[model samples]
Target: MIWEKLKEWMGGGEDGNGEFQPEWITLLEKNLPLYKRLPDEMRQHLHERIARFVESVRFEGCNGLDVTDDMILTVAAQACLLVIHRDGVPYPGLRTVYLYPSTFSSIHKSVDAMGVVTEGRVHRLGESWETGTIILSWDSVEQGARDIRDGSNVTFHEFAHQLDHEDGPTDGAPGLASRAAYRSWARVFSESYADFQELTERGRKTVMDAYGATSPAEFFAVATETFFEKPRQLSGKQPELYEELVGYYGLDPREWLP
Candidate 1:
């Protein structure tokens, strides 16, 4: 909550005069539009967040791609947005972010109880690890930034997973402020997750992505992407889920809704 704010006030990322850097502001303006739409105070928080994140985490380009300040700020700013109105260090366990020029491939293998091993290769846009490693496709990150209302963001989606992993298992539920809050989270998310799961399975058009049915973890990540990107549509189509997300995030994106 105020921990990050206090740290910034104590000169965590502020300049000698305790001001947000002009260079950082220029990078944000040139790279991401949604950051520009933030309210002034929230924007300042995001600025401090980006500064700390850029300093804390390692941003390495893979496959011959060169990561730039624009790329770093774009990702850091969006990740910090999730915490702008909430608590704790942003990505407390995270240490590294790997950026790829485009979608990357990974091998998926599973063994069934019948002693059968299945293997497949899947192309991915973003992925997060319990070891605090985050991988992303630069292409999707830029695309999400270019069009902010698409209800899809690789960076946001993956970082939400990081939050899910914070308390313990990668279950859809995150660590709430209290026991009552946890109960509310469990009830609302369980009901909505089931309903959304059924809606997707029935091949009906839904506001949330069908991929969310993959698991509760995926559902939470997808919910996060929709909560910020397509706030109006999500609020209209899934008011209950919207309220749940609003409660959890402590920020209402309807002000930036298009």
Candidate 2:
């Protein structure tokens, strides 16, 4: 079989054997540092989830760059990390992931609280919409992959928004198991967001990024980056926020930290 056809077969699914292609596994292990450090048990789950995500999400190269197996696998690996411990759909609404060779600009329309309409072109490293489409820059994704300690994986960050959107669009609250879960989530996240904004306003250097102060949804995504990348510091500095993420994700990053 030709290489591309082989990749397609292995990535999409194995007829009788549900396993990833050897080359795809090799590329994932070689390129993703976070994936490499996962416990053997977690790695097995990650591999399965990644293969499923790769098969599910339609990958499109937006510009001239041709999407490679490595590229698709890399992005899929990070995305599936969000649901590693939880028994839930990876991305129930997400259908396509658009890749840009570099940072790209798009025209966005917004309606203000006062019912004013505005449209503007904005440049972004990554962006996600409720429509199950995501746009991301390859450069950002590559950098985020290379530096495992940094809390800025575009793929991870963007997919997190999808999780957050599972509940609704107004806030970053995600779908939870029960009413009590929602209450607890709100109590913890609201307090943490307020504290984060207060710290940012006072010019205090927090482990969390100031960008999180933008909104609850942004906070959830930014906090996700920190949860996965700077788990140690995040757990140390923002203990409540840390626990919330650990609970929501069903895994503790502190355990994976070096």
Candidate 3:
């Protein structure tokens, strides 16, 4: 009811659904032209959805982090682009975004075999929860916007987890449009993940980051960062996985960048 009221107050008059508007598109055009490097149609498609997502999520700056409106919109735009060409499925459960000045520590919660709760601090640049809250660091976000080749992006990584959670848990599986797509996705990801793990174990060099060897979930998120950031490298090294991601995201970074 509050969101509905806020939606109406925000001049989202049509159906009071808080949908994106032409004004937001104009604002995005004026503020986020960097994304214009993408094809015109693709840019337009992403603009509206990105604006809507930015509007829907609440952002807070912590530890004196200067959370500029443009910075938030830019980060949200890039993250939302990964899902723009797909069907409409609202980001399940994510509403608040807490931004920090830099990498922060989070208390990790775990249960032992005896049902004892263990708590430990884990330093991170970004994190996403199934309950709809995503936390990110401003420094990490700024770095990501500047360097697209490092295969490290707080926005992409956290949002990839958001996508993965749509299917339930963030086990590297997102909701696919069809069963056939799921089968293909599973095969390529399984093989690539395995190969990356073996490479890491053998202390071999990899184009992608070794962080992917952390877990299947981390593998998916890290691979997503590489998929968008270093599309040429990912495609050259793991063509099948690249194709699967292209199919899922519906946009080819190679075409955009090249």
TM-score against native, each model: 0.90, 0.90, 0.83
List the candidate 1 regions with Cα displacement exceeding 4 Å: 1-16, 86-88, 112-115
Per lDDT, the best of the predicted structures is 1
Candidate 2 has which clashing residue pairs, if any? none
Between prediction 1 and prediction 2, the one with superior lDDT is 1
Give lDDT tens digits, candidate 3, residues 35-154: 756787776567556546666788888898767755676577777887786545446467888999889998999988999999999999999999888899887887786666677788
- lDDT order, best first, reads 1, 2, 3
Per-residue lDDT of candidate 1, residues 1-258 (tens digit):
222443464484445556665776887777788878888888977766665666568889999999876787788888998887654457779999999999999998988999999999999999998899999999999888768877888888999999898999999998789999888888888988899988888899987788998899999999999999989998898888899889888899998655
How big is the positional error of residue 132 in model 3, measured in Å on the Cα after superposition? Answer: 0.4
Candidate 1 lDDT for residue 127: 94
Collision count for each candidate, in order: 1, 0, 2
In TM-score terms, candidate 2 sits at 0.90
**What lDDT tens digits, residue by residue, belong to model 2 across residues 84-181?**
76554578788899999999999989999999999999899999888889889998998898798867788888888888777678377988889998
Candidate maximizing TM-score = 1
